[model samples]
Target: MATKFALLLLALSPLVFANTASADTTNVLFLAGGRSHASGEHEFNAGCRLLAKALNEQSGLDIQATVINGWPEDQSVFKDVDAVVIYSDGTKVIQHGWERADQLAKSGVGLMFMHYAVHPSAEQGERYFRPWIGGAMETGWSVNPHWVADLKALPDHPISNGVTDLVRAYDEFYYNMRFQEDRDQVLDLVTAVPTRERLKRVINLWNQHGVNGIGKRQTLMWGIQREDGGRGVGFTGGHYHRNWAIDDYRKLVLNAIVWVAGADVPQDGVPSETVTEDALNENLDTYPKENPRIPLPNVEEFMQLPPATNVSMEDYENAKAAQKNRARKAKAKQLAK
Candidate 1:
């Protein structure tokens, strides 16, 4: 009788452990990098790290967000990931065919594209994109501009779940996107209108792109439930990394990630801890502030200043990197809380 009781306990242990492990774990992969921009802007890696921190710490939901600076050198990183958020140049990242989009789609893995990540070159659009994300931002047909957009109304969707008063910011918004033809397959998440005064000012600029014919109401964000039961989202914002500091903006993004991850999005959206500017600066690309394109300074002349003075790009980076390291330690403390 004692041996039989012991065997039953051992058999039940595995089931109990499996249930606990599978219940709330939603794994996310954030792929970022590509073009460089000025200080505090277009910091894809840094933005992604901060986003991961917000999701892990702030969101009441249980999620594990991994920030990969670029596509992983090790393809195994793709294994078991519930969803993916790409925040880089679409063509550059997707060009090599390193990732198998079909397997992910077939497995119902979710996807989210932030900013320029929505546009893959015409060549690769149909092959990998159409089936994965529903559509790609085709050039010539698409008009991208850096303008402030007022998101007065949002469609009812899981991404918009828990959002009551949406906050609008002066971001580098790219409007006039050319989405999939069968509009019913995609659900509009955010509908925004560019500032009329600014739009009037940039008429010639808009016309310069041959924007003679464009729609006034723009759909800047959408959610796609593919026929294969996979999920996807495309957001044409995040050009200005600073926008992540806004609560509504962060909430919307967090919810989308959770929803696409095959998890239950909180009714109030993904709850993130209040993010600080210091936290935002963490894990930024160590590119020189003066020359955003180059990774480091070209001359010793700029490197002569005191470390704190930040007279040169490297000096600034050192200071910032040091600050970020401290912030990371603090992140561990936040998790403890």
Candidate 2:
């Protein structure tokens, strides 16, 4: 009877554990920044909502996703979250709540920063950002340029589960991040060679450092499993909100969110429905009437568009001046009306 009972318990253990695991739901919190940039650009709030919708309805996992505009005044919102994702302009969103964020990190809560959120002040980068997210965009060292990144390959990681095809997109992909001293802990999930020919526009902090980095293989997205048992991810390619329409681009980010939340990424990754044109335009921040709506890129045509020739500093400055003049004229015309 004792021998029979032992075998029966073994057979039931797998089922029991599976049930327990499935019952535990992962909660993901997205702290989206306030309105900034032009129309269809830095749609932080909109982007967060779209991603949250996918996690809740399409991920096929027991996950609850919430999006809070800016930092929550109520501190309790961070209490039960399995992971916190920040998509904003720099670390300004969490500037006042560093203590609380650190506490969460210590307690093994995952953290992720998208686009400009990864470019914190040097002091903050060394103190909090690097340790928490494995890497950050250091000013003078890193460069943000609008370029076509051919993410031709991905590492065999949970974050790369369903990312099977080439993810080619033109956006402000920041490169040459400052990583922690122990780089062995940081896992490079997505990397692309940023050649001069691929650069469309060299803006913000694009100096000699950026010019010298041409043809270098830069890590566009990365993940790290920290010593504290928490996870961290830094992705520098969320600049163009419209790029979310691309399947592979969207899947890569969705997969990272699930992975960082301490949940098992599905074998086929987090499945999300095809993002339609109407969906892309939804929840956009208010911009001037003169700012034209950005059209959804036809993936094939957009990807096939030839790379721009090398951009020079003089050319960039001239373009900036022209853009300013155009904006001024638009505002003047609006006033006349």
Candidate 3:
């Protein structure tokens, strides 16, 4: 009877250990910047919330995601997180905490930056950003142009798991990044050729460098695995907040978040429910009265728009003047109030 009882206890030990291991959860932290761009453009806080909501409610994975506006007041928040995602203007959030962030990187925590967050001062770019994320948008070298990026192909990567079909969107996609010297260590996840026909406006940081690379392929999204067993990703296509309504665009980011967290991406990638116009409007930052609310695009209609072509310099100037006029009038109206 004693021998039989001992055998039963031994059999249940495996089940007990399995349950314990399965209960462990992965923690991801988001550092969102304050209001930066015009309404319906940056939306960093809202964007982070939307993404965190997806991971918490829709991802079907054991992920705990937290979003802190600007930088966290409590530095302890960084402790124990498996990954960190920054969606903000430039590198302001991590400006004062480079050492802390570097410690995280050295300890094998995953890091990712999106949109303008990928841009850092050249000094910081060389000192930290390039090594941390494999690349950074260098001023005088990189160009931010609003164009139709017809992402027709993706490399074979876990981040590309469920991302199928063409992901063409009009965004301020920055290219010509300054990457690490060891090009062999970087994985270009998404690349698209920027053609003269695909460009809509080439105003910011546009120069001889941008003009020379019009017909060449550029890396819009890239990833790297560091010697410390950490992972990093740089994405340059989150300029328009409304673009989040696109399924593939949202999924690719979701997949990256999971992959960076060291979690197993589902065979079909991290599943997320369709984003509605109502959902898109939630959690947006309050802007000045002059900045009118940009309407959320109807997913299907927006996707069906024809490929973009270069806007004539005259047309660009006219549009810029009209926008300024609207802002000036709106300012007067607010002052009257």
Candidate 4:
């Protein structure tokens, strides 16, 4: 009787584990790089949290963020996980690291990627990353003179359905990846106008290195593919926390994850409205004072305009007048009382 009862318990264990693995929403595993500066910690983590929340609320998908400071040793971590979103660019010190993750990912799990996650490595370049991400950086991307984002043409792709034609974004945009074989591997491409310096560089490089169209560039904000008998997607512009709240951005990212997860299409379709990156920086108070080596934009630059140092009465008078008005209003109320 004791042996029979023990056998019955063992039989049920596998059933219980199988049931647990079959989740309502595809399980999303997130791996992020650590913050170099104090505020960056909050910024990077919050962005992942926002992505998970929106995927749950708007797309009805289950998402969990696990910040892998370095590569985790446990291989079974991906056993129940349906998809993995790698936010970490493999910059920090990790034990097993990108190579380990790469091997596991090839075993048929879905992948979603962004920003530094696609940044070039000695082990991999645009070619290697392209298969994993559906796109790779060729090098026109930059954070300087941070330009505005404008969504251009898309291929009538399901992933891009209802996505807006224009939404402003601020980031260090990627440049230089031309499709290796065919454009059929691409789903959508979002671009922004290049700075004059960028334009000239591309032209000169085209003539010099036999690299055609080096500068007449647009950043690839979105890239996707059906490769390795699996689905994969990537976004090149998720380097900031404030991007989470923008309506278009919120929908774009949520949709990307859902598509990667092989889930039902969203009912309301993609969101239409969006906020300017500058507005987000000003209102959210997310950026820092001293420029840290953080890769994304600084929110504080928008919050406080430069102090009136060595300025004339034109500037001082406006501030002074505003202060005087506040004082007058307070005085009037006091006297009335």
Candidate 5:
């Protein structure tokens, strides 16, 4: 399998492209977060731009990925894109630009969720996602821990086209998702068995409302073909943006995007250019230079989280520091008075 990723760029095409005689073009709208745990953790904006550049540069592919840095100021961007790929902090899948989900679903648009995006709260499961992505990460019912996932073998599917064995990655892989009743509509594309070392991290792994997946198989990627003729996919590995460099990892995702967009996926998956170190750092989020890395927050303390997820390390530290600064200033003013 080749190790190149497709980049998507904004094109002046109409609401939809006529793939019949025009190009085999599929316009994919990418959504990345404006903030994250660290400068390069989610790297939503940077990663989306990287994908856009790769797809735009594909030799024979005509797919374009227009990336929205954050939630669009105007929702008109969802006019008629083939697919919507979101890679950000997604605790609420129904929010964001999801207000247009009805329209998109009515038009048979494809939806792709990556990394943290796959983990929506339990309440969101039956409300919106079960019919869309087929499954979602439920709090207390799921686990997120760093593990060296060996994507050695892939299932026979368009999403796994041209993907070879022996793809290894160290990422925060969240597993044990809650799928719909007739789970046959969806299938896992990528599967990995946890190593002994990583298995220890998940002292309590839950799946299907049971304590499962510590010493067994896990689904890292899944695709859903909704009865409405639309498509939905969920990828559990995106915590580390750098993992996108792995050829098989990148190829698998590229193939899925095309497949979801209702485009013909090549036998060798969507070909992408070799991403360089310089390219990885291109459009990263801004972070405090003085504080290189922030400490990881203690989840036990926030047993009752405002959301179903933990705070990004960087954002948590920033908020903590801001509170301290405010208190210090207040004390100083009192002394002067």
Candidate 6:
């Protein structure tokens, strides 16, 4: 696959000869909080810019990352973009911006949100943003000192292939989030166990701000999924200034871009079930663009989900009974053959 990709890039190189060349472009919009007014807060603007650059180079995707300094969220910001990553954690995304963000998330455009950006409404100086990326910020699990992140149950996931474990350089571990209702939607949960120093730090924060801030003290470093009828991912880590350039983090972010772009599917992926033409036509007036590919929130969790069956229960049962009779008849006829 790598060789084929290289050969394909070489094959396409001639297009670059023209200044007006239009490449096979995938546009990515990244929003990052420039800096925080809080004294201890880290400035993540430069880091976000670096992330966009790294993703662009590695994935061959065109990226536009801007530090949304007092920028109002507008629909046009995401218009025609293939995906959007919200990395701003300090400010609460205004109501209008959040509504629009939700619209985009549901419309099949890919979304990626990170760390403090998840906690938009925390009473602290940090503002919590809305839960558009399919997860919510609740509290911390453990305040482990920046420790190693262990990834389990994701051996074959594309984004997790080369990433077995990673240690955060220097950043507060964020844990305890109110995840969305569907657990099946979670692609992978990378846990950052608290170290002795992390526990001590959590204690200090609790003593200073009371017990509300720290609990079991775990934070989400990264995650993936395509759920609620849309494709998206949420990675809450990348707090330390230097972790952004680390090889694993770099690949993780790059893989995330490709996955969210709806270009990369998990191995041996199944196509969505087809809806009947007549029923679809009837509903087209209400949901004009709705297609079989779109998923819905009430769909069963992937693990617990039975195979997709759109036909009525009676019709399904009758079909199964007929199938059994047909099998029996075929077996009886096989003796004659």
- How does each model score on lDDT? 0.69, 0.86, 0.84, 0.52, 0.70, 0.48
What TM-score would every model get versus the actual structure? 0.77, 0.84, 0.83, 0.62, 0.76, 0.57
Compared with the true structure, what per-residue lDDT tens digits does model 2 show for residues 123-199? Answer: 89999988898999999899898888888536678888887877888889998899999997888888888886677
Identify the runs in model 3 with alpha carbons over 4 angstroms from their true place: 1-23, 290-294, 298-337
Among these predictions, the greatest TM-score belongs to 2
Error of 1 at 139 (Å): 1.5
Specify the poorest-scoring 10-residue window by lDDT in model 1.
200-209
Candidate 6 TM-score, true structure as reference: 0.57
**Regarding lDDT, does 1 or 2 come out ahead?**
2
Q: Candidates sorted by TM-score, descending order? A: 2, 3, 1, 5, 4, 6
lDDT of 3 by residue, 1-337 (tens): 9999999989999998877765678899999988986788889999999999999999888888999998787989987799999999897888867898899999999999999999999999889988888999999998888777776436578888887776877788898999999988988888888887677667747656677778898899888989989899999988888888888888888988888878888878888888887888889888657545556655445435554333444554566678889999999999999
User: Residue by residue across 109-145, what tens digits does model 4's lDDT show?
Assistant: 6677666565554335443556665665443432212
Q: Give the TM-score of candidate 3.
A: 0.83
lDDT minimum window of 10 residues, candidate 6: 294-303
TM-score of 2: 0.84
Q: Note the residue pairs that clash in candidate 3.
A: none
Clashes of each: 2, 0, 0, 5, 14, 22
Which pairs of residues clash in candidate 4, taking residues 3 or more apart in a chain or in different chains? 141-173, 142-172, 202-214, 202-215, 287-299
The order of the candidates by lDDT, greatest first, is: 2, 3, 5, 1, 4, 6
C-alpha RMSD of each candidate structure in angstroms: 14.2, 5.5, 4.9, 13.0, 11.3, 25.2
Please estimate how well model 3 matches the true structure, expressed as its whole-model Cα lDDT. 0.84
- Residue 312: error of model 2 in Å? 5.3
